[model samples]
Target chain A: MSNFNLKVPTMASMMANGETPEILFWVGCAGSYDERAQRVTQAFAKILNHVGIKYAVLGTDESCTGDPAKRAGNEFLFQMQAMQAIETLNGYKVTKIVTACPHCFNTIKNEYPQLGGNYQVIHHTQLIADLVADGKLKTKDNKVFKGKRITYHDPCYLGRGNNVYEAPRFALEALDADLVELKRCKQNGLCCGAGGAQMFKEPEKGTKDINIERMEDVKESNASIVAVGCPFCMTMLSDGVKNIDNLSHTAVLDIAELTALSNNL
Target chain B: MAIIAQILFLLAFISAVTLFYKNFKKILRNIQLGKSISRNDNKKLRWLMVLKVAFGQSKLAAKPIAALMHFFIYAGFIIINIEVLEIIIDGLLGTHRIFLFLGGFYNFLIGSFEFLALLVLFAVFVFLARRLVLKLKRFSGAEMTAWPKKDATIILLTEVVLMFAFLIMNASDHQLQKLGQAHYPIAGWFPVSQYLQVVLPTSAQALVFLERFCWWLHIMGIFAFLNYLPYSKHLHIILAFPTTWYARLNNLATLDNMATVTNEVKAMLDTSLVPPTASENATFGANDVHALHQIQLLNAYTCTECGRCTEVCPANITGKLLSPRKIMMDTRDRLVEVGQNIDRNGNDYVDGKSLLGNYISYEEIWACTSCNACVQACPINIDPLSIIIDLRRYAVMEQSQAPNSLNNMFANIENNGAPWKYAAADRLNWANNLSN
Candidate 1:
């Protein structure tokens, strides 16, 4: 969309060139496949490219982190999948990973060590916040989001699961938008009904879906834009917005997308 | 007459301690029924958690009003119990005001105890109103329909009665001291109970009887409350320390990998790796209390039935049948039932009932979003989500039962290396659209 061309390299391609990228961009299953989430992946890559930071993706070598399988009570399948992923990651000697999906970030950072795959993994929001502070990324000319009311939906894996409640907020704060908070935020944030493998299945018979209830918090915030850190939350919240008539105007964008837009990348 | 009172006091003290010991031994045995887990690591951190969360009541600060009221009651419980030491000594030695020799320090101690007794009384009234009159949503969950509701009410009421007995005892004792009655020394301050002296009889003989009656009632009520801890959610008063000490220190996102499953997967992945030796009777996951870790079982026993877990659960808030509080309650109930069953039958007998189907249903287990809000909301670090996951593990692995959607998703993961049916080759497709 801008004047610059974007470059995304693969780990294998980089290693063949006698180069090791600073961080591996783990484009999770959703970021790679889900139509809505692919845009987020593209947007984040554009930001990294504009900032002139060297990053690589696992490409076809990447696999599911088995978060859903583990949470769905398929431990054997989870370990099998985790072992495969760990093998690929360890083969690359990947010591630091950055992912837009909190699920992937959590599994690689916390759960993977137990299975003999360990790395310094961080959610993309943390990377963005750090980049902003380092003067590598600029948001001062953010005409796109100037004065827009933006609320953040905390992904459980990133927030309560990892105790990372500030990095995402810091990213949002750097923008020119008026940062608003949801009624249930941080430690008390509500789920978007897409975790624990519920994202794949119909919720077991409840009066209302969890996403719809969470959307109520978003609606009450009265923010035109709801920023999310996890791709799963993006899909669920986007679908949830379609169900509410008054919230049709509300846009759910990933924090990376917002940052890319603001930076004019 | 004095010797007779001393003998009666000795009998009461011995029987109360013995009964409490017997009941506590059963509780310890029931906790041992769960599989042993090694939480003995991280000794320094564990004690720090006990000091902060349990003793400091740090987590309760999430709700300021409840935290303040609970602090009053908690401080009263700990501080006022020191006065019990004096009562015990006086009862045993057949002495009156036995610690009066400490003089000013004794007055300071009694003065603070009286002040704390009044605060406890006020706090108990507010707690009772919160439960009975206010009808708070967290207190009225489906799991709290009967015994839980009564248990909370009974604990608060008992505190109120106990505090009243304490104040009345001090009040009548003060009046007897004013009259210079025999065995009633002019010792100890009565900062709060002095106000109640207006309600006491001025006659020394009547005042002594009133003081004696209240003193016996207060001590006996405490002993009764001590023994009742095993049967009530009020057991949190004792178990909270151990529970916080043994709580899972890992991030909630990191579900523990099944080591047995890891060995099996490793063997399959690496040809040179030795095939894992399978135990003849190893189960995949927990179906009964015995399969769960002893810490989880302790978590069940330590749950205060506050419904903080349920209150913040996404599934429960959305009207799903999955209440995290109920999961803990059901585990405890089933564990107690299993203990009774073991009592009736020998250790080898099986009742064919389990926590999975008998108490917790498949519907409740599957409804969880696993957001960890429930885990975050728990004031004492009780992890209800772990129990839910264990139940899910039993449902999916042992019985090969799961919701149809999850079953399909699992197959997709097995075949496609993702939750969906996308080819792994297509993972780089998103990058193709970018200009190079």
Candidate 2:
């Protein structure tokens, strides 16, 4: 399998243009771990800072959001973890929070209410899209790349759980990448088979591997590079690219990474 | 014609029809979808079930004592048609127990029916024991947060008293004509009434008056019971046949198709997707009771209050705050609230508070797994799973509020080629690994 690492960005930006933001960023698990995700989170934060949105990050204290536990049916672990996250977020007086992990984003935004944790949460792509629309993240890189064909995979956590479909698409479009549609595009998008604890346990019973199935859909487009919004999908799909030698040339990069790459960062 | 007999004959026949009609309307409106009981379908299973349950008494026989008790009651009640015919001809028309042919056999049949009535009385004592003393879970009350054991006790006692009274009236009359009051052959066989016979005067006037009084009480008690049926466990008595009949044909837990309110989502509005709740009624699935159509209500009326649905429900078992029975009751409670609202201002049901929201919280709405176990367990063929799914559809499509996973899941569906938000260019990458 192909390999990629997830690393998160810094929160040095939110106040660049002098705007007090309503929420804070909690760069999620995959962002902290994946190299490409780290760059995206950091660059997005820089863009937000450039745009003047005030924010804070929970820093080292940020841990795994309880989504993994809940999906695994260990609801007790999910509750405990969620309560801990909520208590930490509350300490920051954070009314709104943002994360790059689709699973984290889902847990913080959607499922946390079950544990009495209520806060307005948005995925990082949504914040980036907003910042771009507000003209904080200049699309100077948009004019440079002429023929960089790319496709996206819907990580179940981000795709099905949070419903942040368009924001990343808008971000990708804004980044000057050639967008190609997949046959099973949107809604019917097959699972990377990573959500609902499939990432941890053995998959129930499908012939093909989950991420392999997802990557195959992406490879069918023959896109030179694939853009991903969620880090877990990045790791799984990136690894999925290596199974076929000829498909070896295909590269999986985060939407953030693609944006950062286009920016000459 | 005797005035009493003429009045009773009309009342009994009319009362049965009236009770049948009321229940029939509910099933027609709720389950049949504009059709009454059989719009045209195979009834072999229904036939088999009727033969097994109604005649063979298989369902009752499974619980021997309860079966014996029920057997007495139903058998007594069924054969009592003989007594009814006798009353119409001999008692009402003043014909003196005369048979043109097979007089011995006819008398023997009457005697057998009279004996069965006494056995029926003895059997009812067992039914009372089951309904009151043992308190089966199937007979739990509407909420079942607590089982009200007393109400069932009273109803069972009343049935026994009234039915035995009818038998006493028949037995005493038969004795006067066939055996004489002194010998008391038929009355002697009935221990409860025979003891009372000893205390009363041996005069024919007293015998007639007692018979008349007992006859009036029996018939009136029957009418009162009919009216009380829809409101009590006795509703099951009327509902059981159709429930069993439908259960024989339809898979109760299998949900009906949801009314498609999403309009197939014609154009992908990426930047400006319409809010999910854009149905003409601003509804998806079952936003309101009428959104439920008729079969849903049939599910409500047909519920046996057995708690089998509740016990098998994974959501309830998982501590998710949803029970299949509670879902049914929520529908019931919603119907009541909406019904009251519609009554107050016809077609203004839209303004009232949601009865579903009060009991079936939004969290509870989404917790359901759509498993059909509850459907499978329902003896009446009520499908709670369908109702739950419809409500979930309403919550998602119309309400625009859904469980977190659901919202993102739909988003993923709308966007990242799957429920996952991966880039489209990556779709074929996985094919690289598999040997073509």
Candidate 2 residue A151 Cα shift, in angstroms, is 46
For model 2, what TM-score does chain A reach? 0.84
**Where does the lowest 10-residue lDDT sum fall in candidate 1 chain B?**
B274-283
Off by over 4 Å in 1: A1-7
DockQ for every prediction shown: 0.77, 0.02
lDDT of 2 by residue, B1-436 (tens): 4666766666665776688577555434434321132313567777776566545656444346666766777787777666555544543444434342445566566667666767876776766765667776555534565433554566768867776677667656654644465423332234344444555546677777777777667756766676765545456665566555555243221122221321222113133655454545434456556766555665566554557676655345434466788777667656655655655777544674554576677666555544355664554556676666666666655566654554554444334323345554443232222210
Error of 2 at A264 (Å): 55
Docking class of 2: incorrect
Q: Tell me the whole-model lDDT of each prediction, alpha carbons only.
A: 0.90, 0.58
DockQ of candidate 2 against the true complex: 0.02
Give the per-residue lDDT of model 1 (tens digit) for B1-436: 9999999999999999999999888888999998888887899999998999999999999999999999999999999988999999999889887889999999999999999999898889998998899988889977887788989989999998899999999999888888877788899899899899878877777888899999999989989999999999999999999999998888877788888888778888886887567565778889899999899999999999888889899899888898999999999999888888878886887988989988899999989888999988899999988988988998999999998889998998898888998997898899875852
lDDT by residue (tens digit), candidate 2, A55-91:
6665555556655434423333344456667766665
TM-scores for all candidates: the values are 0.98, 0.50
Candidate with the greatest lDDT versus the true structure: 1
* Candidate topping DockQ: 1
